[model samples]
Target: MNKNLYIFKNKKRYRVNVRNYNQEDFEDLIDLQRKAFPPPFPPDLLWNHEQLTSHITRFSDGALCIEVDGQIAGSITSLRTNYANESHTWEQITSDGYITNHEDDGEVLYIVDICIDPDYRGLGLGKELMRAKYETVVYLGVKKLAGGSRMPGYKKVRDKLTIEAYYEKVVKGELDDPVVTFLMKSGRMPERLMKNYLEDEDSADCAVLMIWKNPFIT
Candidate 1:
C-alpha cells in the first residue's frame, strides 16, 4: 500500500500517512495522548519514554504512527502473543503498554491502544490506522487481530444498566457509543467482556475483548 494518502474534506485537501514510529516521534506521541484523551482519562496511564521504547525495540512492526501535514497526529501500539481460552488483564497482556510480553512465536497480534489528535479526528485517520493493522495481520500471517476496547459510553448509563447489558445493547445496535461503534463498524467482532481491564472511569474500568480474524490466513 502507498505510504502517503490524500483526502479532501471541507473543500481542503490534507496530506496523511501511516508509518512505523521513529525516535523523533516520541515527544509528539507524548503530547498526542493529552490531546486525544483528556481529564478523567488518567494522566498516569499515558505513555512514557520507557514504554514506547519497548514498543519500538521489541515489536517495532506494531509501533505505528499516522502523520497529518508531516506532524505526528495519531498512533496505534500493539504486540505479538500466543493465546487461547484464557483470561488476562490489559497490564498482564501488554506489560502495562510497554509490550514487554511480546512473543516471537506468538501467532496473534494484540492492539494496546489507538489515539488521534482531536484536530485530526474527522479526517478518518483512525480508520486508516485500522486499515494498516489489518494489513499487518495479513503480512505477519497472524491468526487474527486482538484487542480490549474501552467503553467510555457505559459510564453515563452505569446507574441504569450493567456493563454487559450496555455492551449487548451496543452490539445489537440499540445504542451508539463513540468507541465501540467505531470498532464494530471497522469489522472487529466482540469476543468477550472484561472487568477492571483499564483505569478509564468512563468504561467503569471495563473493556470488551474484540477480534478480527484474518481472512488471508488459513
Candidate 2:
C-alpha cells in the first residue's frame, strides 16, 4: 500500500503520514499506548512485545501508525470480522488475544484500539487517523466501522448519573464527553452502552458501543 500523507495547520503547520505498522515500531507503539491510557487498566492491557508482533504478522494492513517528524505519535489497530448478525462482547472480540480474532474475509472493520501521544493531542491527529480508517474501509470494501468508545469523562459524573443517562446527555449535547464527543463528531453513532468494556477507571468500567457505516459500501 502507498503511504498516505496528511498535512494540516493547527497551532502551526505540520505534516503526518498515516502508514502501515512495521516491526521496528513495536517498542515505540507500546510506549505510546502506556502514556495514552490512564489507570485501573493493568500493564497487561497494553499490548506487549509478543502481542504486537503477533498482530503485525497476522494482518499487517490492519495495524497503522502515524508519524510526525519521523517519530511515531499515534496508532490505530483493527481487525476484520463478520458481525452482521452476531452479538459480541469486548472480551470476545479481543479475547483470542491481540487481534487474534481477525478474519481476512470478514465484512466489518473492528477497531481494536487507537491512541495518540499526549503532546500530539488537539492537533487533529485523532481525526486524521479516523479518516485513515475510513479510507481503509473503502479500500477493503467493508460495510462499516464498529468499536467501543471509552467514556473518559464518565468517571467524573458516574455517581450523579447512570451510564445510560450519561450517554443520553452526551448524545443530546447536554454534556461534553471526551471520547463520545469525538466519536459522534467523527460520524460514529452510539448504539448502546457496554458494561465492563475494559479496565479503565476513566470510563468507569463502561464503553459506548458505536458504529459508523461506510457510505460507499452499498
Candidate 3:
C-alpha cells in the first residue's frame, strides 16, 4: 500500500502517496475530521491504522483516504450487509413504517461517513472520495450503498444549526443536501428512492440508501 499518487495543483503539483492510514497519519486525520465536522468527535475515538485496516479487511467493504497537495483532505468508509427479512421496514423519507412483499439476498454497502476540509469544499474532493468508495464496492460485489443522517435533533443542534434549520424550512431543497446532489449528479441513485426520509430528529430519521447493481453481479 505504499504507492505514490498525484493530484492537480496550480503552478506545480507535488507527488505523494495515496494510501491507507498508518500510525503517523492519526493526528492529521483527527484535524481534518474536526474541521469537517460541526461538533467534531473526540480525536481519541479515531482508530489507528492497525485497528482501522483490520476493521476494513475483516468486516468492512471499503475504507479510503485522499491526499491533496501532499496532505490528507478527506476519507470514506463503507460496509457490506443484507437486509432482506427485517419484518418491519422503515421508509427513507417521511419516516413512516411499512412492510413490503419483497425479498432478495442482495449485497448491501453502507457509507459510514465522509468529510473534507472547509477550504476544500466544492473542489470535487468529496466526489472523488465517494468514487473511491463506489469503486471499492463495485469491486467487492456490493449491490447497494446506504447511509444515515440526523433528522434535526441533538446531532444537528450540536453541529450545524443553520444547515439543520435550512433543511427544516426548505424540506429537501438542493441548498441543504449537497450529498444528495452529488449522488444524483453521479447517476448512481434513483430519484424515487427518496421516499420516507425524515425531516426532523423527533420521529425517525431516514438514511439515504443508494443502490448500484453490478453489471456482472447477476
Best by lDDT: 1
- With candidate 1 superimposed using the best TM-score fit, by how many Å does residue 94's alpha carbon deviate from the native? 0.4
- Candidate 2 lDDT, 1-218, residue by residue in tens: 44656566654666678888888898899899899875666677887888788778888877888888788989988888886335566768865447777889988888888899998888778888888888888889989988988888988898999888988899899998988899889878888888877777777778888888899767
Q: Which regions of candidate 3 are displaced past 4 Å?
A: 1-18, 40-61, 84-106, 149-176, 190-205
Clashes of each: 0, 0, 9
RMSD per model, one decimal: 1.3, 1.7, 8.0
TM-score list, all predictions: 0.96, 0.93, 0.60
Q: Candidate 3 on 165-216: residue-level lDDT in tens?
A: 4444334543434555566565455323222344334313433445455556
Ranking by lDDT: 1, 2, 3
Q: Could you give me the TM-score of model 2 versus the true structure? A: 0.93
Off by over 4 Å in 2: 1-6, 84-86
lDDT of every model, 2 decimals: 0.89, 0.82, 0.50
In candidate 3 the C-alpha lDDT for residue 73 amounts to 78
Q: Which ten residues in a row have the lowest lDDT in candidate 1?
A: 83-92
Instruction: Write model 1 residue lDDT over 114-194, tens digit each, in one string.
Output: 999998888888888998999999999989999999999987899999988999999899997888889988889988888
